[model samples]
Target chain A: MAVDGRDEMRPEDARIAALYRHATGEMPPERLDSAIRKHARAPKDAVKPQKHTLWRPAWRLPFVAAALAVVCASVVTLLVERDGGRLTVPPETPPPDGGETPPFSVQREPPPFSQSMTDRATVEPRSGRAEDAPTLTRKRAEPPREAEVRKSIPESKARIGERSAAPPDGRVLGAEPSHSSDAPASRGNKTSGGNAPLAYSQPPAPATSTSPDRVTAPPAPRAEDDSLSKALPAPSAEASPAAKPAPAANPRPAPQPESAPAPEAKPAPEAKALARKRLESTPSEPRVPARVSALIAELENEPPARWVERMLALRREDRRQDAEALLAEFKRRFPGERLPASLQQNDE
Target chain B: MLAYGEGDVAAFDELYRRHKGPLYRFLLRQCRDGAIAEELFQDIWTNVIRARRNYAVAARFTTYLYHLAHNRLIDHYRRRAPAALVSYDDEEASTSIEEIAGSAHERPEAAYEARQKAARLLELLQALPTAQREAFVLQHEAGMSIEDIAVVTGVTRETAKSRLRYAMAKLREGMQGWL
Candidate 1:
């Protein structure tokens, strides 16, 4: 071979070249070639390409691990969402087209209290209508301005004056006279005579009338009057022979018109008192004991349904004496009526 | 080469026949032992066969082959005890020029002189340092250019050329009368 001119060959290069030209290393024995050829042909003799791959065994572990990790992550995400009470629907998407709102949406405002009362009136017409008519009358009577004006008045002083002044009008005697006007003439004198003393002896009428005005002024007293009017018919219907007594009692009518003016003059105290009296008198029972009357007066602001619940709560808090007294008064006021299950359970 | 990689046994056989003699001689001269040379030769070709499916023709096949051989030799040297690599310069010089020259007879004398010269040349080649010997062998035996030798041996062209020069100088000094 010719040497590159760039490589300046010493004389030794030419001599070494000449020596190397005549001599090369000995060839490997033929057996080595035979052995190597046999090795190279070994796969061919089997007639199959190698099933093994650099990727196969190595890839399996990583792929399996990745798949398992994906599954585990999915499971954990679902569990966490379920435990947290999160809705499955994505936040960005609108909920499925059911008429109802999605669980995550803000809860709808509760139906109005008046709307619920009207609904109850429709559901149970007998007692509910009677109860609802007075409430509706009360709602209609008190203008919003008058209620706001009443809120500024000292409620306790107003209630005390109404209670103290009520007996002199002889309104308690008039309730009996009104009963006589509705009752039969023969029974009217007898019923009227019996009621006049009872009315005079227990000046509960003034107390009851004063409570309504104290608790709820202009509107509620109007409701109490409507309720009392409604209540008068019930007893007359139960004892029509006593109806003649109502007309005889009606002839001496000092208290009849006074009832309406009493509510307008002291709306809060009279409304509260009237509500308590209406509630007690609506049933066949004629009178509520003084203790029960006081208890009912104390709870004048609370809905009637909650009275039992309050008594039971008092008992549960270990106020045993107060609970027992309240329960006994409730039983006396509502004789022959089934007590609420919660109150009964607590009593046992 | 691509066909050989595709499992064409005949193709591989042709490739083997073309390169085997030079490659075997290359390893044999480097190791200066028959068993080790055969072992290295088999190992290199086995690697070639195994690497076939992934083989891309990036450079000349010979350059690629010698590159693998170069790396294998380095690994072999590392594995051996240091004492095994004591210099063979004195041993090579002990063989006299007259012994290498022999007589001036026609056929037998010529044959005797040829064998003696071959033995002496091998001794000189073995006495050279590993890098220089590799450069000389790749140049003369494999017929690789300086550039190819540099590529195969992982060095600059100038380094490969210098190694070849040093190796040639050493051989010439050892066999001056024969030249």
Candidate 2:
């Protein structure tokens, strides 16, 4: 494997040795300088050296090239194979010896929300889930008063009308046996009007595992209310004959089947008034939750929480005007709530 | 060379002044043609200038310089087109021979004798293989060591030694009483 060039070398055997010694003997130190200068200054286009000076240290180049190639290949192979032919997951720390490794990190799946986001709106009903609802106000009292609001609302209205048409209690406040004439309108509300928006909002509530109280939060209540008001007539309109029961308790329930259409007559104006009236009437603390304020602060510092994404999705679906109207109303109602940067940027 | 390697242009000029004559003489002896010798000489010096920036203390300055020269000559022959070596006509041959014979610039008798001897030596040298001639010239005329010669000739020291041996034996046989 190794070539030993000097082993059997003999000075006399090589006349070259003698010639070289003789030739060099005649050369003075000054001559070497002159020759080197003349050679170095020679124009490149001129003929090459009569014979090249460099012996090449012939293996040096190949050895260096091979070493470089090995280093590069090893680096590439390490990148490819170390992760079993998948993309490399760079080591979290660089080697202690201080050589370069890639500066990259692999993305991991998002953390499960229920486990991590404990304070989220997971407790509310599917229809008016608080998380699905954008926060339009920031009252310190909303969280504590949620149950009270649910209790105060007409239970019949709260029944999320689709799943079970049967009354929670057999008491239908007022139902005339001959009242079958107007049943179609009530069914229509459930099928096509306010209840339609209600049903649509409900899907996100369950999917997002958020509460309806989130939607009803007074801060951005108008958009939430608008969506709700749009969804309301659907269920109300869809309520079938089965949903219409005979009078059990009082006459008010009887009128609801009739007055439900009243909501349809001027829903747009009424929903806005209802939201304004609710904001004015409710106690300051109960109107907006402290948690919501904290979330607002967090969003102001960072980006908006999840509902902003839904809003964006809506915007992307050619609902830009709707989204803009809702966003402006939300910002107005929740004066201090921070909008996400993208929304803020768009607004500016 | 050391001074030149350190960037002294004066040193470079001095080295040029010092080595040019000897190198020219060596080239003249090896090539037997003034034009070829001058050309090879120029090449050797030009190479020295090009390599000065990278120079280290390698062997003696003399060895390095001529080592470059020795290899340049070899490369020149290798690179020359085959047809370029066409036989010279009588006039050109005689003129070249006379020039070579006149190269000894000593006293008349000594010059004549040295010319005859050099002529005879050149004839003997031409009879030897290229490798042998190169080895002999580098060793005896250039005064390079077997090791340095190996470096210049791109051969093993053993090979250089073999060529020198073969060359010497032939010269001894061909010019028995000449030296």
| Tens digit of per-residue lDDT, candidate 2, span B25-119 | 66765566667776787777766777776788857787788778777776766677886552312122222323333433332445565456555
What is model 1's DockQ versus the real complex? 0.33
- C-alpha-based local distance difference test score of model 2: 0.43
lDDT tens per residue, model 1, A1-348: 334557676675765666676676466578877877777666743544344454566779898999999999999877654422221111221222322121110111111111122222121111111221333334334244233223423443453345445544223332332333232233321222112221222234442342223221111122343334343443223223323434332332111222322322322333234433433433222344555456545643332224455576777887776677767644432232245556677678
lDDT (Cα, tens digit) per residue for candidate 2, span A11-76: 433443333333333332455444555555555434445334343546578888999999998987
DockQ per candidate: 0.33, 0.14
Model 2 root mean square deviation, Cα atoms: 19.8
- What candidate 1 gets wrong by more than 4 Å, as runs, is A1-3, A8-15, A42-348, B85-111
Which run of 10 residues does model 2 chain A get worst, by summed lDDT? A103-112
lDDT of 1 at A313: 71
Q: What's the true lDDT of residue B55 in model 2?
A: 83
